[model samples]
Target chain A: MASHTNENTELGKLKQKIAGLEKLEQQHKKVEAKLKTVNKQLQASENQLKAYNEQLRESEQKLNQQKEAAEQSREFAESIIDTIRQPLLVLDKNLRVITANQYFYKLFQVSPESTKGNLLYNLGKNQWDIPELKELLKKTLPEFSAVEDFEVEYQFETIGHKIMLLNARELLQKQGKERLILLAIEDVTKSRIYKKELERLNKELEIKAEELQQILYITTHDLRSPLVNIQGFTKEMEASLNDLKKLLEKMQIHPAEEKSLNTIMDEEIPEAIHYITSSTTKMDNLLKGLLSLSRLGRQKLTFRKLDMNRLMQQVLDDFEFEIGKNQVNIEVGNLPDCMGDDLQINQLFSNLIGNSLKFLKPEVPGEIVISGGRVENGCRFVVKDNGIGIPREYQEKIFGLFEKLDPKKPGIGLGMNVVKQVVEKHNGSIEMESELGKGMKFSIFIPD
Target chain B: MKKELKIILAEDDEGHASLIKRNLKRAGLMNEIIHFKDGQETLDFLFQGKKDKDEIKNVASLLLLDIKMPRVDGIDVLRKVKQDEFLKKMPVVMITTTDDPREIDKCHELGCSNYITKPIDYDKFVAAIRQLGLFLLIVEVPDLNNMI
Candidate 1:
């Protein structure tokens, strides 16, 4: 019986050992499934990590490109500021120069390094330290919204004294956190001097016009009274001669004396009367011409829009009879419209064109061209004629009142003077170019 | 029958007055004409201190006035004559060398019978005055004898 118990105990111990080994195998299988799951999760994590690193690299490249574009835009803005021609400067609220344009440096004759970061008044050995500018920066800048046209006449070391118009405005920067001043300077010395000179010349011209008016008034009244007396007595002399001749005829003189008296009455007396009448007529005509010339200054002018083409045609038609008799060819080109007195312009053109027809070579047909062209500050009218031109020496003298080049040409010599008066009254200029036997050209310039 | 009228001529210029008298004679108006050298002399002859003076007191007369006279002008003479009840009946002819339209209008504004512009040409002047001389014979005028 003792031997049987011992064998049972051994069998139990052996079964227990086998059961423990089975438990160890189940634990090992559970651990292997967990390890498989952990390995799959780790592989997924590695793929996600690679994707995250690639996204970070793309973001960095975009940031670098945006930085470069912002840098390029800043350079473009700076270049645009440098291109301004006027002397422009930017200053901080304390009046220290922040930035300046290229013109500022060149105008002040200072380098950019010397200009920037320096006080505006202290720049260039304190040349800009003017009282007006000091008043502007000290009081006007803070009170007014802007400082405009503050004139500062300052003398510089390099350039002479200059009149500058300084304009300034307060500008806000960085969302109103900081304030800046934008100042612009312009030089107007030359224009100011020119305006003063023009005013002086205008005063002189007014005085000259007044003096001419006084002279004209005296000539019109004082010179005409004696002429009238001489004209009236001439008629009386003719009447007296007629009565004497009748009385002598009735007296019954001798044949020899009668023949002598007939010669005196018929030839000598008539010839003397003819010469006197002709001379008086010429004197009367000259006086009348002067009267009319002076009257032009006092006459009221009616200004209206006139078509030069139509006016030329009308003037040409008025002279149609003379033109046909002389076989003169008149051509009119495109003419500009102008504002002027119709009567005066008509007279002007008639005198010029009539001279063209009258002064033509005896056998040659006259040709005249009336045209208008553009000038620099105004319009130009050209009257060209292929006729007997005036001599060069007489060109200027022809404009004088009663100045006749050819005494036998049947003109009172006042036409050219009238033309000059009309042109000068309209503030225009006339130039004549001609040779003795060649063609003549009259160029007139009138402002728009 | 209408009595002949006397002519009162006031002229400042001697030559102009002589030419006018010759032309009036040539036109064949047979009337007595008195001449005054200046405007003051003319006013005295027409309206002397005594209103009734010999030939001019009772007879009807035509006044030929020249403008631009010394001391008193034709316009002033016309004003004075028209204001007088007795002399207003007398016909007045204003003759002058002034051809200004304003002066002609002014003369018409005054009670003048005719405004004649003396022509600068001798022939035209003679013709103008001859027309006036012929007009004097035909036109009826108020008598100064009946005005009082």
Candidate 2:
């Protein structure tokens, strides 16, 4: 029994060894499969890595070429800007000169070598040494977008004197900072001096304007009071005379029958009445015109396009009674239109025509003709009267206040004055041509 | 038919005032003459729907008004009067040097009785006064008691 057991144990050991061999074989196969799969993946990864490396090399080459192109463009643009005739400066973020025009180098009295790539403040030149300029530039940094045109006068140890304007602006940005700045310098010393002179003149003009205003006020006020008194007294005296004459008429007992009454009425009564009436009328007109002038001086004038046809018709209507009484003939031709104040222009017409009727030639019968038409950029108006024409000396004088051509004719000198003031107010000019015996003609040109 | 004479005088200039008064007197106008200076003063004297003041009770025969005056102008005064019940009847004669046609039209629109541009001739003016004075003599003076 012991020999059989020993033999079985040995067989068992052999069997176990067989099993172990089988297990080893299976493990080897599994490991071989894993190695095959891993080798295949490794080959694929190697191919991908080679392709990626090639692409990266191409990208790097393109990047290098782009960088080179950018650098070349920057240099070319800088050279182009620096070639300008005007003094120009290109500064980088650090206020260092990236490029400067030839004119700038000459103007600043700085050598090109020293100015290149140097900080502007450190140039050791008149403009660079200026403390004010430095302070202004430093304070105005980055946000400094205003175009300064003020004159800057620089005097230095080396250069005699120079005047310039510093005009600068932020040109470009890069890397979250100002990349470039452009500055232009212009010389305006003479113009600055001229502006200062202009300022001085403006001050003088203001003073003169004030003086004129005060004078006008004083004159209007003083003259108005006296003129009022004169007008009052004249009317009172005339009225008293009229009352006496009327009293004589009512009584009908004083030697004047029909013929006698006719003689008195025609000769003495009419003559006296004419004197008193004309004188008072003239004075009244003067005062009223003066008042109007004063009002004009005091108020702001409003002007607009005035239809001449409408304005003249109305003015002529006002003269209906006077025209009828004087037996005067007025023929109005085609009137030109213009922009003007209605009231003032109407006054102008009335005064001119009224003047014509007043200065009548003896026994010739008064007649007036108004004619005009449009011309280039304006309209022309002519007033021709068949009355005693004005003398050359009196023509100019006629426009003056209280100036009259004929003292014998009862009129205040205000008629022509009104005409002139109104015409000028309308932005027009007036010219008068007259013969002492024939008549007077006035031409007025008003711009449209 | 003769209309009653009642007159209003609006004048700011002292000389204008006296001249007007004297001429009215020579015209032998016994009708009441109510006078005021500035336009505002004249307006104040006439407006606010109040009954005519005792001096203006006759309804004013004629208005001899000047256009340029301190405070308010004659044009303003005339405008106010024409808009009123009693004062509009009075003939408003613009007796100033300004013969502005617009002023005449405005006066006419506002119911002015007439507009007379003050002429520079003293004698002619007296004659104008004489004519108006003759009208006054012919016109019956409105009795204040009978006026509305």
Candidate 3:
């Protein structure tokens, strides 16, 4: 019985111990379930953190793209400002230059350091301190939103006098939050000088025209009065000789005396009268030349389209007799039409061609060529003659009034003078090229 | 009183005056001629300033005036003479070497009786003087002293 109770106690104890272990095991499972719940919560928090990290990275990428775009736009705006041709400047409201373009640096002959951030009127050795510029920027531009074509005339040491047209615009800078002045400068000195020169030339031309009228008056009246008297006295002397001749014819005379009277009347007296007549004729021709030249000054020019080819043909035809006598070969080349007075041009060509025909060498056949074409802002005509060329000593004087190369010739020596006058009337120029015993070439340039 | 009409030739040039006198003789104009060297002398001879002023004033006369003269021009003399009522009807003829149309028109505007340009051609000049001679023979002269 004692052995059996002992066994039973031992079994109870063991059973109790086993029950405690089971309890411990159940408690451990509950603790493990709670731990699983906590681990799931931790995983959920980590996923949320990863999503937050991705969002932060995307926002940072977007920020970088915006920054790049802003930089590119800024660069493009600066390039646009640089492309303007005129000198451009950006200044603060205080008239301090904030920035200047490359043209501004070049035009003012200054570096960016000297120009930028410097007072606009105190730059480049105070060359920019012009009262007009100061007045415009400080007073005029501030009063107005924009100043256009405000002229500032200043003298620069390097560039001499300069006329600058300033254009200014008042602008509000959006980013910097400041008032800016946009200044543009244009140089117009060349055009201003051209206008001044043109006015001066016009005044000179008016004075010259007045003087020409005075010359015409003196040449016509004062010079011709004495010539008329000489002509009248010669006629009186001839009448007296006729009466003396009749008286001598009625008287009976010795042979020797008759011979003496006949010689005196026929040879000596007739020779003397011939010289006087010829001299008077020459003087009369010279006076007529002067009159014609004077008349040219008063004549109103009638401008018309003139066909040079047809005119040359007509001029050549008019000289057919002379040409035939001289056996001259004339070549007419391509010629351009010109605007001129027909009568004066006809007279000019007549004199020129007549001179060519007159000066032809006796030993050789004459070659006369009339040729020309359009040139720079004008037409050029060349009259080349293979004839006796003018001497170098007489070349300059040939165009003078009453200048004669050959006194024995019948011409009054006014042909070249009239030619020069006519050329001047047409606003053209004639230049002679010659070498003695070689040839003569006259080139005429007439402006369109 | 039958006073002969005289011709008064006012010329600065002596040769022109001689030519006129000789040509007038050739054309049978036998009138006595009085010559003046300049415009001032011509003015003095007329308007009763010269020694023979009374004789010249009593006679019927014609005045031939040159446009160009020393001291005073022919236009000034014409202006002075035409301004005076007594000398206005003196029948002045303008003789000049200048055939400028402006000068000719100016002389005609000044009441010149005739305008004659001294011709450079010998035959034409003599013919022009002869035409003047023929005109002198026919034109009637008013007696100034009788009218006064």
Candidate 4:
């Protein structure tokens, strides 16, 4: 019986051992399943970390590109500011210079080390500290946001007296940042001096012209008085001689004495009277010419818009007889209208045409051409004639009073002078070109 | 009754005075002529009584004045004579070398009876004097002595 009970216990223990083995196996299986789940979770977290690292690298590259572009833009603006020609300055709200352009440093004879960050009034040893500049900057600039052509005349020890025009603008920064002022300077001293010099010269010219008129009046009047005396006395002597001859004829005279007296009355005395009369007449004509010249200054000028073609026609008509006699060929071209005095212009044309007619080369068929056209600020007229042109030596003297190319010519030698005077009165200019014995040409410019 | 007319000639130039006298004589003017070399002498003789033996008072006189004289000019003499009560009745003629229109107008404005520019030509001068001589013959003279 004991042996059979021990066998039963052994069998039970074996069975229990087997059950424990099985449970342990199941727990190992459960642990293996948990390991699989944990592995999947870890794999998902690794993929998420790799994605975040890629995103961070892209963001860093984008930031670097933006930084390089900002640097390039700053350099571009700085280069543009340096290239400006005019003296330019950038100042802070406190009126201290923040920066200056190349032109400003060069013009002010200063360097960036000494100019930048310095107060505008203290720069160049306080040379720029002017009262007008202070007014413009402190008072005018605040009211007007921008000031243009604020003139400041200052004397610098190094640069001498300078007339400057200052233009300033308030540069308001974005987002209510600090404000800056942009100032530009211009120099106008040389041009102002030129204008003053021109005015002084014009005044001197007017005074000289007035003095010349006075001299001409005195010379003509004083010379005419003596001329009248010579003329009167000559007539008296002629009358006395005639009376003596009549008295002698009535008396009985010796033959030899009568012959001598007849010679004196007929030849010597008459010759003397003829010479005296001719000389007096010549003197009278010269005095008349001088008087007329003096009177021209006192005469009033009446300006009119003149048709050049019609005026030229009237002048030619006055010389119709001479033209027909000489058989001179005249060609009238297109003429532009101009503004001048009618009577004076008429006289000018008459004198020019008359001169051409008077001096024509007798051998050639005389050809005269008159033409005109519009020019800058005026009209230009050309009067060309095939005539006995003046010699080179005598050309310069033609416009002077009483100057004659040929002394034997009939006129009093006042024609050219009169022409010049009329042209000057109209604010016109005249030019003459000629070759001796070839032709003569006159080019006149009269304002419209 | 008409009083005999006398001529008073005031001229600064001796040659001009001689020529005028000869021309007047040729024009058949036989009146008694009195000559003064300058405007001052003429003013003295006319305003103040003459002390010379040939001085005649209370005569009907005609004045021929030349401008541009020494001392007092002819314009002053004309102004003085025209202002006087008795001398204002006498005829005054201005004969001058100045033909300026302004001077001619001034002379007429000063109450001169006639203004003549002395022509430089001898023939024109003689003809002008002859015309004056004929005008003098027809003009009725007022005697200064009869006034007041």
Highest-scoring model, TM-score: 3
lDDT by candidate, in order shown: 0.81, 0.72, 0.84, 0.84
How displaced is residue A213 in candidate 4, in Å?
1.9
Give the worst 10-residue stretch by lDDT in candidate 4 chain B: B49-58
Arrange candidates by TM-score, descending. Answer: 3, 4, 2, 1
Q: List model 3 lDDT by residue over A1-448, tens digit each.
A: 9989999999999999999999999999999999999999999999999999999999899999999998999888778777776889989989899998887788778999888889987888888878888888888887887999999888887667999899999996688687899999998898889989999999999788867866866766677777777777777777788889999889989988898889998789878877876677777777777776776777678888899888888888999999998899988898998889876887788788888998999899899999999998878898989888988988999889889899877888989899888999999999999989987899988777
- Inter-residue clash pairs, candidate 4: none
Identify the runs in model 2 with alpha carbons over 4 angstroms from their true place: A1-94, A97-182, A185-307, A317-329, A336-338, A351-368, A385-424, A429-441, B1-148
Q: What C-alpha root-mean-square deviation, in Å, does candidate 2 show against the real structure?
A: 16.6
Q: Which lDDT tens digits does candidate 4 get at residues A91-197?
A: 98889999998988887788899999999999998888898888888888989989999888888877889888899999988987987899888777777788899
DockQ of each: 0.16, 0.18, 0.46, 0.30
Q: List the RMSD of every prediction in angstroms.
A: 11.0, 16.6, 11.0, 10.0
What's the TM for model 4? 0.56
Residues B1-148, model 1: lDDT tens digits: 1456888888888777877787788898767778888888888888886735656766778999988778987888888999898688788999876554456777888889998866545566778988998788788878877777
Query: Which residue pairs collide in model 1, if any?
Result: none
Q: After superposition, how far is residue A437 of candidate 4 from its true place, in Å?
A: 18
Residue A227 accuracy (lDDT) in model 1 = 44
Rank the candidate models, highest lDDT first: 3, 4, 1, 2
- List, residue by residue over A1-448, the lDDT tens digit for candidate 2: 8989999999999999999999999999999999999999999999999999999999999999999999999889778767765788878767798878878877667877888799887886524767766655666745565457645687755665667788877775657775677778876666777899999999998778766755664564445455445544655555666676777767756554757765775587667655755554555555565656655544445677888988999989998998899888889887767777777777788888887877777688788999989988888999899887866776678788777666666655667877887787778899999988889898888877
State which docking tier applies to candidate 4: acceptable
